[model samples]
Target: MKYRFPEGFWWGSASSAAQSEGAAQQGGKAKTIWDHWFEIEPNRFHNQIGPAQTSTFYENYRQDIQLMKNIGHNSFRTSISWARLMPDGINVNQEAVTFYNNVIDALIENGITPFIGLFHFDMPLYWQQKGGWESRETVEAYAKYAEICFNLFGDRVACWMTFNEPVVVVEGGYLYDFHYPNKFGFRMAAQVAFHMMLAHSLAVRCYRSLKLPGRIGIVLNLTPSYPRSQHPADLKASFIADLFFNRAFLDPAVKGAYPAELVSLLKEHDQLPVYQAEDLALIADGKVDLLGINYYQPRRVKARMTAISPDAPFMPDWFFENYEMPGRKMNPYRGWEIYEKGIYDILINLRDHYGNIDCYISENGMGVENEERFIADDGQVKDDYRIDFIREHLKWMHKAIQEGAHCRGYHLWTFIDNWSWMNAYNNRYGFISLDLETQVRTVKKSGEWFAEVSRNNGF
Candidate 1:
């Protein structure tokens, strides 16, 4: 069966500031959590490679934008580093303004629509010292930072993303040891999650107040969760998991309110975040004009066989145990299991529960280990596996569109090989491979295939 994407469907790739733009200390950029973490504990990063020398997008954006044009990108996504622009999240930096202006102009000159994201897992160290997302002061500082960007670049950028994969901020930084701050306390994690949502909502309000000619949205990494069995307990566990992982942000961003059940559950356990009535009002009034869903995998969950202790410390995993279903498709490179159907489930949920708000697959790609193994003699990678990975997911995405879901586009995780947090340059997800040793870019075989898809809208 031949399926074609809708006319004017967006085609492009996504990238973050910290992962792509090196020169962390240059361009009047202040220290971020990543920079401070590396300074304190250099061994935390993969191969001891810090965030100082990334793909160097800050210096090579002119040429890199051309490469994006060559790869058939119509709309490319990149984040404006808060620390780079504001240095302290309170004072605006002029050089950073000129730098981003050049970037936006370059992308526009090449006929690529610029999608700007405000925050992407990197927190300014000054704000982190002020209690990071756990303090109301940081939330207000973020709103000011958002206002700065909207005032500066809102005219050229038509799509503004408030935050990217916020759960990762909470999960990786507060609840786990993967990211900076590396605190394993559940109370701090809950507080961070609450304030992050508030910050997003506040930013949405700020953008709306400006009446910018663009769309404001949040980029969420959505994983359609599955219960391991037909039992009622298992089903409840899955629902609770969804409430925490997906609904936490989706409810406020799309539906304009927090999930009542979620709040009730947290309150019952005395884990409810402290909030003022004005904060609730802000969230209720703040709504997204669009939604960016990043789907890479699904979550299979089962109910815990043992009864929960009312006195136990709070955590999202308190209700369910993660079930790794046997014989699942796995990304051997990144150790993440892949499930194509997760995309369809995510779209359908948005349609039914979230008022079917305008949405798109914001980040989906395959990460490969030692991708050079497929490098051909003619200077291209025979990355057939990546092509297959993307094709399967796109098939499901196309099916979702036909079934009346409002998905508008599909953008891969990255345009070129770049660094990932903690893992540094371990897993490559780029359509175009980058040589870290020399910073040269080579279009992989998958890039050629994707270019055809972009040209034809589908194959």
Candidate 2:
């Protein structure tokens, strides 16, 4: 193995409850925001497909765990559906508890470590009705819910995450129109972002209060921002973009604070979110024990040449302009740039700037549209492109590790081709491909190769 990883490197994949668990309306589970959104505006989803029907992890988890073992996975990550566990976001659901326990027990039985995440953007409709993350009440409820999960499952689950890609919740739901309850405004975005962080701190406090046997953290999708040129203006633009996207959450999670520059900029624009006097101390308590980074692309920025009118809505873009670099590598299947070295850049940045924190690649994989077109004989998907994608990214990541970055593991975006929100399986990203119609799972060529990589501890 030319690119061998350190001993005990974790190789696995991630999926969320909302994306993989098909019993969206069954098992005493109440409606989630995704379920309700699909119900009213089914047309908004691809192929008019919604979360009501999924890869059926709820029913097929046992078989799936066996498959994971066969494919040489030593760890796996998935979220518990808050909506399923607490239909009204207050009381416990015993049936859902039984289901989750079975899933966790089965994973251990098969020699796979379980990484449980509490929230993954699947807000219970009951909570959404009460203003979701925007309301302080939801923040308090979330902490209570975290405490319940800890008392119930924290003994066996040694790894936990408070939320996955929380900034996406703020950007997608409040700043942009891509998500449900979409309203475009910076004030709402800032407020929601603050409340979610507060909720994370409270949950961290709850976990510490119980002294659970696990380490809890948050998963962030960290895209490294690069200036198009070395010019000071372009550099400043890139710095601001980084502040808004990466450091906004990273600082609080790792350092128990926000960047001073970000605070000054927000203050200059009179866009500070309303926070309690004690919120600062609480946020300082939210520092994580581990960090999960999801890296897929890089953001290239340039100085803003045009001025924003005073009446224009304040957005992160107002301070910088996105610059599309010519001749950049791209993944045409999913319309995302393919920059393998960006992984190294991110790891090195963490090593140099963030105290070399313990971290791992939680979600990194290629998604291909119409992947059935690549099927080969012997009933397997001939996904060489996916193989090359993983190998190149791993190569860069290996270099970072060699340079003293504290990266611990790498997990693909998914285990099976689960339903992606809104995109709904349009782009398949899994070592095991799924037959949506018949619910069959077949290991792709990359899966065989990955099993070998796991067995060898690298490629």
For model 2, name the residue pairs that clash: none
Model 2: lDDT equals 0.93
| lDDT (tens digit, per residue) of candidate 2 on 244-343 | 9999999999999989999999999989999989999999999998899999899999999999999888899998998989999999978889999999
Best by TM-score: 2
Model 1 ranges with Cα > 4 A deviation = 306-312
For each candidate, C-alpha RMSD in Å?
1.2, 0.9
The global C-alpha lDDT for each of the candidates, from Candidate 1 onward, is: 0.90, 0.93
Please give the TM-score that candidate 2 achieves against the real structure. Answer: 0.99
C-alpha RMSD of candidate 1: 1.2
Model 1 lDDT at residue 244: 87
lDDT of 1 at 31: 90
- State the weakest 10-residue window (summed lDDT) of model 1: 305-314
